[model samples]
Every structure is written in C-alpha cells, then in structure tokens.
Target: MSYGTSFNYETILICLVAEVLNLLTTFIFYQVLKIPLFFDTIFIVAVVFYLGFVPAICVSIGYSLINSFMWICKTGFFDPFIPMYGLCGILIVFSTWLFAKNKSDFRISVSITLLYLFLIALTSSMCSIISGGLIDYFHYKYYEVTDMMNPIKNFSEGFIIQHYPPIVSYILAQIPVSFLDRLIATFTGFGIYRSFDFFMKRR
Candidate 1:
C-alpha cells in the first residue's frame, strides 16, 4: 500500500458494516414502517467524512451494485434509481471531502456533525426527487393504455402520480420524508461508527 493510491482496507470494512446496517434498516422500513424505497445514505457520508474522496467513490460503486442486485433479486426487475444511490455517494464524497480535509474535523464538534447531516439530507433529497421524476418518465413513456378507468398501470403511488402537476407535487412530497430519513440515518450512522472507532482505539 502506498500513500495516496493504496487499498483502503478501513474504508472497505466500514462500507461493509454500513451495508449490513442498510439491510437492517430496509427490513425496518418496509416490514415495519411500510415504506417502499430504502432510505439510507448515512454510512456513505460517514465514510467520506473519515476516508475522503476515493474511498467514498468506492463505497458509492459498491453500494450501488449491491443495492441494485438485491432489488433485482427481490422484484425480478431493475430499479430505476441505482444511479441515484450512486449519486448520494458522489455528493457525500465531494461535499465532505472538499469541506473537511481530515477525519478529526468531522467529529470535532456537534455543530459540524449536524451541518454534515443537513448536507446529506439535502443531497439525498435532490437525488431522490430527480430519480423519481426519471422513473415516472420512463413509466409513462412505455405505458400501454389498457382502459380509460386506469390508464396509468404499474405507476408508483405518490402525491406526484395522478396529480395536475406531477413533477412539482412529487418533489414537494418527497422533500419532507427524504430530509427526515437522511437526517436520521446520518446521525445514527455517524454515531455508530464513531462509537465503534472509540472502542477500537481503546482496544
């Protein structure tokens, strides 16, 4: 391993842990909370906060692949939002890596952590909305009108669907939930990693 281009073992390990946590949260959301999409970007953001740009990119690539694979296995089709999942990593890597150069800075103060969480929320919100719009576009583009009663078959149910102005309604409906989901995951993931890091240091 060299200085800049070495294999990021630590990043890989943390990303794996994050992936496990994502699975758990997915169960909680769909099985319990009854949400459709998986909402978790905290691990990726936390990784960027610790490891910087390159590792974050790795996380994004790995996370996107894993997420897409899992969804395809479950639903027997490809999800339209794999790119958005990757986008979350790109946003976190660049935003946090450019803003905070060192690991210590991320955990330095409560304010900084909150700020980072807010940024993750904002980024996730934007990506989710854009992805939603893209998905809707593709859905409508290939839509085969079966009957007048239900022209939009297999369309995702949301405020945006069947609305007068779908794009605006969809975005507006997505923001509140997206912000809250990312914010919670950001805080939870950051705290879990930092706490684990603290114990590891003691060991």
Candidate 2:
C-alpha cells in the first residue's frame, strides 16, 4: 500500500476534518457529558468505510496526536502516553475494513448488520485489551505516573484483580467497556456512512 500516493491533498484535508469532528465528538461525550465511553473512533471507522485504510489510519493517528495535545493544553500535564491508544484505532480501521467496509447500504438486512457490529465489537475488545496491557506495562515499568484517568475502569480492575491475575483483571475490566463502546461506534459509523452514500447517490 503506497500510502504516499494515497495521501494526496484532498485526502489530507478530509483526514483533518475527520480529526476535528472526532475531537468534538469525544469532547462532547467525555468532557461535557462526562460519559465514560470513548466514541472517538466513530469518524475513523466512517473514513474506513467511505475512503479506505490509509485515509482512515491517518485520521486515527491524527485523533491520537490531537487528543494528546489537547490533554496537555487543558491540564498542563505532559503525558506522552496518550498516543499509545492509537493502536486501538488502527485495530478499528482493520476490523471495519474487513467486516464492515462498503457494506453500508439501506438494503442490508438488520440481522447481518447486527452480526457485523458484534464481530467488530469483539475484535475491537481484543484490540483494546492488548493495547491497554501494553500501555499499562510501559507506564508501570518506565513512567512514575500513578494516576488513573477513568475511575470506573480503575475500580473494575481493582475488584477483578482480587480474583484473577492483574492481566486477567485488566482484560476483564476492559472487555465489557470496550465491547459496548465499539458496538455503539460501529453502529453509528455505519449509519453515518450509509447516510452519506445515500445523499451522494441522490445528488
């Protein structure tokens, strides 16, 4: 995949718009409403369904970098670890590409759509587990940062840690959360993709 050729000026502009809208969506859900779920990948998945992997990956990386910068700007805390979560976005891009790409049509059956969402959610859950584990490993092994950003996730991990190993606890804590988040993101992403396709076709 020659991403250099794929990433033209138009692609860059679209990715920038995706990143800005993603940032807005995330801020609305996470900061304004205090929602724990990260719907940040909706636009990235949409880009995957609409454009392709390269453009979607660009949006994903942009989301991570822009969010990291925003976090530092808001809190004055320079945690370079924020961009590590972009692994989850890359995972979403592939999952969407494989299972949901170009499948956004009004003629598609509800059962099949549900199945696609479930499969994407399952894959995304695994991705989040792996990414979170790596981030936590690096954080504990190298950095002195002890602050847990999400108290609910921290509490869930703490509770599960008593019964299972820390790794298992971490995985368990993230599965439901990641699953729900991806489920919503995949559904909304495809819906938006379908809407755009429909509008364009009408035009």
Candidate that would win on TM-score: 2
- Top-scoring candidate (lDDT): 2
> lDDT per residue, candidate 1, 30-119, as tens digits?
557766444556666566555556766776677778877876787677756544446645654565455445555666788986786677
Q: What does candidate 2's lDDT look like per residue over 62-173, in tens digits?
A: 8888888877897788886778878878887886777654455424788877777778777877887677665655554455553435423564557555876655565566
- lDDT per model vs. reference: 0.57, 0.73
Off by over 4 Å in 2: 1-10, 102-108, 140-148, 160-163
Clash totals in order: 0, 0
Superposed Cα deviation of residue 76, candidate 2 (Å): 3.0
